[model samples]
Target chain A: MKLQVAIDRVDIPRAVEIIRQVAGTADVIEVGTSLTKEFGVRALGPLIEAADGTAVLGDIKTCDEGKYEFDLGFDCGFAYLTVMGSSSLGTLEVCYASAETHDGVMMIDLLECDEDRIEKISGFENAVYCLHTSIDSGATADPVGQVRAFKAKYPQIRRIAIAGGIKKDQLAGLAAEGVEITIMGSAITKADDIAAACAECKGLCG
Target chain B: MKLQVAIDRVDIPRAVEIIRQVAGTADVIEVGTSLTKEFGVRALGPLIEAADGTAVLGDIKTCDEGKYEFDLGFDCGFAYLTVMGSSSLGTLEVCYASAETHDGVMMIDLLECDEDRIEKISGFENAVYCLHTSIDSGATADPVGQVRAFKAKYPQIRRIAIAGGIKKDQLAGLAAEGVEITIMGSAITKADDIAAACAECKGLCG
Candidate 1:
């Protein structure tokens, strides 16, 4: 299990500061969707640089024109890029192909996708299928339970990541449930001692 | 009927030049999702200025954290912003409220939503319900007929917009079908003479 700290709603300098603080402590540092939209993927070179060798994921949340968006994100030095699971299958296929070609990772964000939709998009072997809860809908009540249910429903999906208001207390359960990545946003990034918070969360995930 | 010209896959200077050419002729000039992702919404001030008096819409395509994205887009001086219909109902509600508060319009992108999902999200009275076809899925074969079917099914949705590879020949039929907005991309933007193509399409719409 790996801890992915998502940095959102902050300017590039501040995002860079946070990345530098938590780079080695967190397994992956995510450039959140808000930062991507506010600053643009091309402008994220500083954040990418701040991460040093730690893997960086850009939560671009692509819905259409997948190849273009994926190519742009990877070109900007993102280790992983996200695409919406709600996007058309063709879009998903193109995004996956782009990821494969770029030798980067693709994380499919299943924000509002239903079971039938997920089942149809479950064939990507290397892609990480994320069970994401919308921020507007609030935090996931039982993330471990959610992962368990998701695993039971779609056992074929090997790479699983869970996100949306995840706290440190739930990291162990998520790891025990075989969650490949446990993404925490404000819980770790906005803490009083950001580095210590990330280290604690990473320790818990182990 | 309104002719909304979408400018996509071009750099900022090129986007500004295109806006200058077609601003007054097209009713709305869309800063397409590609531009928003590539250049960032905050950096679109030049494009907004180039539109002059014509409405400029930022295709932000908000899926989650609606208020934040909407506020950012609206604050950047976009007359309209888009939200995905596939978003959670809660996300949609916040986006609508943000648009209302900003005195801007919200265009709901119905890309991959089924009828049930559309019905569930159809209550936003002021929103322009866009019957969008994914670029990856190829062009819409019968846009006017698609609009007719959508209207027949969801009569409660008043402000209807259709997009995706719309050509000059389809504008009259879309207008006759009582479509509120007909969006064209490369057909007009990528044409040899963009201004003339826009003027001709505007003439066809009338």
Candidate 2:
């Protein structure tokens, strides 16, 4: 299991400070969708550099213009970029090809995606299918159960991730249920001692 | 019929200049999703200001963080903000409530959204349902047929907007089909004379 810390809705400079602070403690440092949209890809250098050899993931959440967004994202130094599972099959296909070209990674955000849609986009060999619960919809109460349900439906999806208001308490269960990466935002970033909070969560994932 | 001019993938200053140039001539001036993400809502302040008395639409394409993004967009002086139909229903609700509270408008970007999903979100009375074709999937060849089919399937939806490679020649047909708004981004913005092109398109809509 990996601990991915998502830093969101903050000023880029402030995010950079947080990124440096969390350096090696996080296996995956996510430049949240808010940051990408707010600053564009040009501002990702600091975050990528601050990762200190750890993987960098940009939550681009691209629904269209996949190749342009993906190419720009990869050029900006993300090991992984995301495409919406609900995007046109064309968008998902191009995103996959772009990621493969860069030898980077692609994570499909399954926010509000139905089973039929998921089935259509299920065959990306290197893509990680994320069981994302929307923040507005509130956190997933039983993430383990959600993952189980998702696995039962799309067992061909080899890599799986869970996100949205993930707490430290659910880490063990998520790991137990074979979730590859658990993404948490405010729970860790907004904590009193960010590094210590991240470390504790990383410890649990380990 | 309305003419929506979408400004995308351009720098903030240039977008502002173009918006200033197109102000009252365009029924709606769209700050494309790329701009919103690239420049953030703060950068949009002047562009919204440039709209003068004309309606400014921010294609924020809120895939998540509906309330925050919509509130930010509204506060930035946009008359309308967009939320993706592919987004979670809760995201749609949050955006709708925010738009209502601000006395603004919500445009649901139906990019890759299926009939079942559209059926579920067809209840927002004040929302404009857009029949979007993905840039990744290329343009819809038969805009008239697409609109006719969509209207027949979702007749309860009162207002309709169509986007994706809408060329100058199709404007008359789209208008005759009772399309509420015909969005032309590249066709107009990329024209030899943007304002002249916009005027021609608006002529057809009127």
Candidate 3:
């Protein structure tokens, strides 16, 4: 139901510019994994500042040393941080605890994870289980269908988010399906008018 | 057998100092995942310079967007970069290609992968399949046994590496088992005399 605009593969100055353009329209602005890995979480203060009062999520995609990575991201002013679902249960638990302690949210990226793995990592009441498709693997075909299936399989997971090449046309379906967050990367960020594109996407999500 | 000293949870200055201390003794000096996430790969030029041709590896741990992350890491002058085995096969393939194109090595970090997943991702001839134990999952109780079992199951994988709380006492067994690379973290980097500890571990590997 919320539009999350992801800014990626750009320098901090450009990322800050994009954040400023979309801050009023986007409910959440994601500092993509590329930015986090390229600039480090500590260096993202400018983008965070540009977001003003809008929520910011850092797609750190933590695979190990969860507490350290999560603490660092939260300390850097990220309201939401991501951890890989493929990480060990202990890693997931520590990340969840860190999020709770920091009063932030945790989004578990379910990229390349099977049902068995997902079933085991469920039950984090506050955690958002993201049904993500890998960029290399191409765009997700049917996000609405994917969310329907995921919800059916793991009905206990309350907070659901979907990401990977999300377009404006699919935002309504995702919102109708009750997806908590719909992440759009290049579609909104690379548009001719960044602010206009984000406003349209935000309107669609409603 | 080779001794790969991992430098983690430290700042750039301290990392450079540790690299200087262990450069002569360590076959490979790993700029640990913590450093890469905290400082970014581009900012590791000093650490790479400190290695002085001891073969520095950036534990970039590419999970998705493999080509971009791999290219960024390899371009940053890392002789080696890591990709997560839990990543999609497509991601793994792109990472492998990037490593090959960059004339660098790719180390697959098998942190929480199962047999079925491993079987699907094997056969990157130049890749070092690292049998890694999650730091959150406690230290590997028997690394030798773990390597032996891995080899028995996947003999096609020729280049093998092992990591996670590796101690001086276990180096001999790992060497005898013909592990290609043994990654030691705090045991070597956190020692009172980092250079001396690295020398002892390298001697044991031989």
Candidate 4:
């Protein structure tokens, strides 16, 4: 499993600093939704540059105007962008098309979406369907089991990712579950030794 | 009834220019989600200052990390910020609390939310429940009927706003249906005389 470290709720300079520390350890370094909302994608040039060679994911959490958001995020140097699964199918279609045009990845955040809604939105073959639990709702009780059930239900969806309070201890389990990416936020970014924490998580993923 | 003009898909200079042109004509000036995503809320200081006393509504479109988004948006001079009705109950609660603490307003964007979800989230007494049709899904079929049905189903939701391709012809009808705010995007902003179009909508609202 690839380790995606989400950097959020911090200022631009601090975000860049954190990226400089953990980018080498994370497979994909995510500029979280808070950073994008607080600093805007245009202002994230520095953060993108700070990512060095690591893939940068901008958690724009786009819900509408998919083409515009995805195009802008890609132009801003994000290798990946996110759209909400709760967005209209039309929005999702446009986002997937935009990502293909730009040769970038689109990660669908499946937060607050029901099975019926997910079933309707499950045909985006290239998009990574993320089983995300909201930060406000706290951590996922059993992320491994959640992934197992999601894969069992949507067997056709080959790419899968998971987020929400993921800890280092859970990395090996997520990897063993055949999850593609496991996103960690405070677990690594807020640690006393962020680089060390990220390395530990990466080691577990390997 | 009030007329809220949305400024979207434009740069900071153009957004500020549009604000200067119509700030006096419209009751509320919205910094649309496109601008917020492309430019970020922190970069909107000049636009906020240029509103010239008109209430600036930043469509931050908070889906999660509620307190951070709301606090940042409100602090950035938005009189109101938006949260998705599709968000978790915990997210909604935190957003409402943040709005109350900031002495600002929270507009719940019911874009793709169903009746069952709306029923569960209708309790934020101070929130303005916005009946939004996705721009990608095309304009609302019958906004007036939609509002009436929404009111009938959830009378407890007192404050109501509606958006998505609202045209000049629909303004008075929406007002007559007791819609609190009618949000117009390209209808007025893309008009030859934006200020005049806004005045015309405001006239209908009055």
Candidate 5:
């Protein structure tokens, strides 16, 4: 499973420092929605450069004007961009097409999406379906079981990612459950020893 | 009736210029979703400032992490911020509470949100319930009729804003229909004389 470390709620300079520190450790480094909303895409050029070859996923959470958002995100050097699963099917289709055209990945954030909605949008083969539990709702009680059940229900959605308060101890179970990417936020970045915590999580998951 | 002119699909520099040109004409100057995804919120700061003491609204379209997105958007001087009506009740609650605490307004973008979802989230009295049509899906065919139907269905939702390709011709009808805010995009911003067009639309609505 790939490890995506989401850096959020921090200032730009501090974020750049964190990006440099965790560059080699993270398979995918996410400039969270907070940063995207706070700094704008062009300001993130330094962080993208700090990626040093790793994938930079901008958690844009685009809900409308998909082509414009996707095109701009790619231009700003985002290897991956996200669109909400709860967005209109038309918006999602545009985002999927934009991602495909740009040779960039699209991750569908299933924050509040229901099965009916998910079923309608399950056709994006190259897209990663994220079972994202909202921070406001707290962490998922049974993430591994959640992934297992999600995969079982939507067998065709081949690419799966799990996020929301993913702790270090849960990596093996998530990896075993066939989650392609496990997103960790405070679990690594907010830790006292960010690099050490990241290394520990990486060792366990990798 | 109030005029909310949306600045969309332009680079940050151009958006700044457009906002400055229309600053006093429109009641609400919207930094549209397209602008939010392009230059980002940081780049939007000057545009926010360009509103010339008029209220600025960032179409941030928060689907999740309500507090983070709302806080950042409000911090960036948006008098109002938007949350997707399709997000979970939990997410909406967080956004509403945050908006309330910050003395900011919440505009619920009801794009593709079902009747059931709308029924569940109707109680935020302070929020401007926006009946939004996706640009990706083309403009609303009959915006006046659409608003009338929505008002007939949910009279409890006191404040109403209508968006998606709202032209100058429709402003009188929307105003007659008791629409609080009429969001016009290319009709004004992409006009031969942008500021004059904005003033005309404002005159028609106001």
Candidate 6:
């Protein structure tokens, strides 16, 4: 399991500082959707520089213009970029192709999507199908259970990631459930000792 | 009928120039999703300034963090911001509230949404329910037919907007269908003479 630490709602300099502290500990450093929308992907030179060889995932949450967003995100130094599962099939198809062309990763954010919708969008073999709980809707009470059911429902989806208010204590259970990536935001970044918290979560994932 | 010219896939300087030219011709000037993602809404000061008094609609297409996105967009001088109809019910609620609080407009992007979904999300009385055709899905063939069908299906939704490759010739038909806002992209912004194209479209809308 990979620990993807998400840095969100902070300015560029602060985000850079946090990324630098957690890059060595986290397998993938997520530039959260807020940062991408707030600062734009092109303006994240400092944040990208601080990743220090770790994968940087830009949560662009592309609902449309798939190829443009994917190409720009990858060009701006993101190893992975996210596209909304709610987007059109054509949009998803192009985004997946763009990811392949750039040799970058695509993560489909399955927020507010029903099982039927999920089943229909399951053809992206290379993309990570993220079982995300929306922030406004509140965190998932059972991250492990959510993953177990998602895996059973779409057993063909090999790469699974979970996000939304993920706490430190929930890390080990998600890791045990074989979730490919567990994304934590405020839990790790807002902790008193950000570095130690990230290290602990990484250790739990291991 | 209102002509909302969408400025997309262009950098800030070009966008500013386009807005300045069309500010008088168009009722609303949309800073498209591409520009918002590429240059951030906060950095659109020049475009907003050039709009003068024309309502600037930021196609933020916000799926979550409703209040945050809406507040920032309104503060950045956008009269309108978009929220995806595909977002969670909770997200829609907060976005509507944010719009009300900011005295701003919320345009709900109805991309890839089914009738049942639209039925459930049709309660926002003040919102403009935009029947958007995804760029990946290609241009809407019959803008008039699409709007007629949408209005017939959801009579409660009073404010209606339609977008996606809406051409100058199609403007009069869309206007006859009583579509409140007609969003044109490349047809206006990518024209040989942007100002003339926008004025012609505005004339057609009349």
For candidate 2, give fnat to 2 decimals. Answer: 0.67
DockQ of every candidate: 0.91, 0.64, 0.87, 0.88, 0.74, 0.85
Better of 3 and 4 by TM-score: 3
What are the Cα lDDT values of the candidates?
Answer: 0.94, 0.87, 0.93, 0.92, 0.89, 0.91
Write one digit per residue (lDDT tens) for candidate 2, span B9-33: 8887888778876788899999887
Off by more than 4 A, model 5: none
In model 1, the Cα lDDT at residue B77 comes to 95
Deviation (Å) of A55 in candidate 4: 0.5
Q: lDDT rank, highest first?
A: 1, 3, 4, 6, 5, 2
lDDT of 6 by residue, A1-206 (tens): 99999998999989998998998789999998788888787888788888988999999999999989998999888999999999999999999999999999999999999989999999888899998999999999989888998888898899999998787788888988889999999998999999999998899996
RMSD of 5: 1.5
Candidate 1: tens digits of C-alpha lDDT, residues A83-122 = 9999999999999999999999999999999999999999
Residue B24, model 4: lDDT of 81
Off-target runs (Cα >4 Å) in candidate 3 are: none
* CAPRI level of candidate 6: high
Pairs with backbone N, CA or C atoms under 3 Å apart (clashes), candidate 4? none
Q: What is the lDDT of candidate 6?
A: 0.91
Q: Between which residue pairs do clashes occur in model 5? A: A40-B40
- Model 5, residue B49: displacement in angstroms? 2.8
Please write out the lDDT profile of model 2 over residues A1-206, one tens digit for every residue: 99899999998788888887787988899999878766666666888887888898998889888888888889878999998998988999899999999999999999988788889999998899998889888888888889988888888999999998787888998998889999988988998999899999999995
Candidate 6 lDDT over residue span B1-206, tens digit each: 99999989989988888998899889999998898898787788889899999999999999988888888888888999999999999999999998999899999999999999999999999999999999999999988899999999999999999998888788888888889999998888888999998888899987
Using Cα atoms with residue i matched to residue i, what is each candidate's TM-score against the true structure? Answer: 0.99, 0.95, 0.99, 0.98, 0.96, 0.99
Pitting candidate 1 against candidate 6, the one with the higher DockQ is 1
TM-score of B chain for each model?
0.99, 0.96, 0.98, 0.98, 0.97, 0.98
Native contacts, share recovered per candidate: 0.86, 0.67, 0.75, 0.86, 0.79, 0.72
User: Over the stretch B7-55, how does candidate 4's per-residue lDDT look in tens digits?
Assistant: 9999999999899989888889999998898888999999989999999
